[model samples]
Target: MSNSSKAVVSFIVGAAVGVAVGYFLNSDKKDELVEKLKDQKNRLKEKWNKRKDQLQDELENEFA
Candidate 1:
């Protein structure tokens, strides 16, 4: 293979190996991590929505 092709193959192999190792290492904690991330995302979204509503209400009251 050409040098560029060799590099591409090396990169793909390296990525696959890295993902496999990381997956194996984190398999047990994956669910817990995912749940925590989901909960955090929900909380942030809720806070943003509430702030947006409050701002909108203020703007309406000020101009009305």
Candidate 2:
């Protein structure tokens, strides 16, 4: 894409993210949103750790 096109796309994405953050900050359900985000974060961490352990075990078995 052209430079101007890239700039426009970036601006649009930034505006969309700003609107989302503004809505969440202003909404009455902010606490619920925070809880949901935290839960998602935890689940992602668990999945990451599990994958890392699996990779480590595989490497050990391959080399051992």
- TM-scores for every predicted model: 0.60, 0.79
| Model 2 ranges off by over 4 Å | none
Q: For residues 1-36, could you state the per-residue lDDT of candidate 2 as single tens digits?
A: 999999999999999999999999999999999999
Cα lDDT, all candidates: 0.93, 0.99
Kindly state the number of residue pairs that clash in model 2.
Answer: 0
Scored against the true structure, residue 13 in model 1 reaches a CA lDDT of 100
Report RMSD (Å) for each prediction in the order shown: 5.6, 1.6
- The per-prediction tally of clashing pairs is 0, 0
Candidate 1 lDDT, tens digit per residue, 1-64?
Answer: 8999999999999999999879966799878877888999999999999999999999999999
Superposed on all Cα atoms, model 1 deviates from the true structure by an RMSD in Å of: 5.6
The window of 10 residues in a row where model 2 has the poorest summed lDDT is: 24-33
lDDT accuracy of residue 51 in candidate 2 = 100
The TM-score measured for candidate 1 stands at 0.60
